[model samples]
Target chain A: MKKISTPYHHGNLRQALLEIAVKLIRERGADALTIREVARRAGVTHTAPYRHFKDKASLLAAVAREGFEMMVKETKDQFSRTTQDALARLKVCGIAYIEFAIHNPARYRVMFGTGRPHGKNSALRKASEASFGLLLECIKECQKEGTVRPGEPMEMALAAWSIVHGFSMLFIDNQIREKGLFAADRESMMDVVVDHLYAGFKPN
Target chain B: MKKISTPYHHGNLRQALLEIAVKLIRERGADALTIREVARRAGVTHTAPYRHFKDKASLLAAVAREGFEMMVKETKDQFSRTTQDALARLKVCGIAYIEFAIHNPARYRVMFGTGRPHGKNSALRKASEASFGLLLECIKECQKEGTVRPGEPMEMALAAWSIVHGFSMLFIDNQIREKGLFAADRESMMDVVVDHLYAGFKPN
Candidate 1:
């Protein structure tokens, strides 16, 4: 194999490295990924990756941070695209979360995996908090609109998160398919599942 | 350091290997677990592990199978301890599931991780089916008792599974604590979460 080392500019170099790292993690599981291997794949000197990533953990943190941002963006885009009520918009956000997991299982795994960034104030941690904050905000909106039951918004948000996140994991892990619960239509299946959660959230 | 190679009977050797494998997985995570490592830790010859486990995948499959069986037993034991109604027993079963994940995060991860056994007919797969089947039966009983709303038993079961499973994953992954959502009192917290799910399952 011929090594193609293209000289990348500083800004582009980091982007290229991250892109390569994401690709490596996707092709091989995160445990198999390494800074040196990513550099090798990028056709750059082994030390080049060190300029951006101190170690594998940092690289994974960066990947997770990117995942959270992208997820937030995608979720927001989906819900905003619809002119539905707050509860309906929240359902759209749930669907978006699942779709993100389906489309980017590798990134999703890293984002939620045990190896995700730690500490309460790390960039990755903050990004994750923001991701949950998105849901909390939606729950509050639903409550304000009187579409959802009155309760602690955090607890309500968590109930919704549990349903969507759990379904995503089951779907991605092939458990749903293995059980033959996932017939051809994923959207409709999720629609019903989300409605079941909404039933609990409905105002009396 | 000195090595201790305590000879073991055939049946005991397999059990020892599994126990060591589980310990190794808990300490270093499943990716770092190897049959050779288990052998070394067990003070047995490397080749000896092959007698029980054909490879790493098979070793993990055995671990996952054991995890499923243990989970089913624990959930049943907890729910049966109380002479509660069907829905109450089902709630108890959900609590048991989360407790199992909390106590055996490593084993739980292995049971649900990507590296779990493949193929539709494997023993591991059957064990997982039976695990879900337990939940399905609980939902069925709840329906028969007129506690749960009428619907496809499988869908209702999936709805219940999603909440507990999702909550388990979040707690095990430390996301709950990271978000400050888990303020100690795991059982109470789980109780409230499971109630939200029950809100959806209740008949109108």
Candidate 2:
């Protein structure tokens, strides 16, 4: 491949490739993503992407990692804006999760969809764990405040994560719409689902 | 295209095509599913599948419908064999849900993963609703037995459904393994998650 003149240096090339890849996924779906296409869209030489990402899978992993980081930031931003009540802040984080998935369905799918497993030490896996760790912190805070029942915080975090994650997947995948349950009112449906979860975590 | 005669009749031909399509998806990913490939694998002429499916999307919808029916039957079978305690039965169904997804990851992804939306009256949509309706019935049963708190059965069902569905997706997608959360003992992790959900639904 002939080298093309471009302004992007080695440092910015990876970010350029990821941004272009995300655009392709958002507009045409993940199947449309190809290293060549990303390079073309980025206005960089075909070999440029190769320098940063060893393969398409590596590029996808990087995108997924970016997605996880964005989710953690989004959730934290939501959490910070809410009341200090542990339960209330947790609810806010849960809602933020759903909203983020709703707004970024393609990215969300890439983040959680079928892909090569990133090993424990991989940046992608670490980013994902960091996002999950936020939820664990919320669960622990709720326990400390006596709002949530005492139990394994990891288990409680898993429960809360499952509810939100499941609901988001269903909503994004059009299952909720197909069922005609809360089809016309998604916000209220989310509230009801979260309320049930809140009740579930309350001290008996 | 020449019409190729086979052992299957009209009704059986549809089933054969679906089976072949499912096999292709299982071996390859969903993107590997194409009308021509399914027809070739089914030992029929390339045009034969068009007679039953119209297009690739239609064929995928049929497969998804079959998946939903199978899930409903699987859950019902487990529900019937469990003890009379509503909570116990609900747990059985939840476990059944996870097991089914773990065993049939490809079909489960086809059923719940991103795809063209099935309209309200579509068979695929109806089958999915029927599956979810079974969960609602379990929540109602728990309410009758005074195991679960009395509330909107729909909301409670959504809560229960979210946790199980989310956990199954995470497990099947290899997110749990990738994060090293429950690498050695997935079964135990599943139990803990379900137990928390069970406690969540109890009357406070």
**Cα displacement (Å) at residue A165, model 2:** 0.5
Per-residue lDDT tens digits of candidate 2, residues A1-204? Answer: 745555446547777788888889988877667888888877777778888888777788888889889999988888778857998888887898888888998888888775335654378878988988888888899899999889888777877888899999888877776665764387888888877777768886
Each predicted complex: what DockQ?
0.53, 0.56
List, residue by residue over A44-116, the lDDT tens digit for candidate 1.
7888877877766777778889999999999888877888888888887788888898899888877777432
Model 1, runs deviating above 4 Å: A1-11, A32-36, A115-117, B1-11, B115-117
Q: Give model 1's docking category.
A: medium
> Top TM-score: which candidate number?
1
- How well is each residue in B49-103 modelled by candidate 2, as lDDT tens digits? 8888777777888888898899889888887787578878788878888888888
lDDT at position B2, candidate 1? 42
lDDT of each: 0.83, 0.80
Q: Count the backbone clashes (under 3 Å) in each candidate.
A: 0, 0
Q: Highest lDDT: give the candidate number.
A: 1
Q: What is the lDDT of candidate 1?
A: 0.83
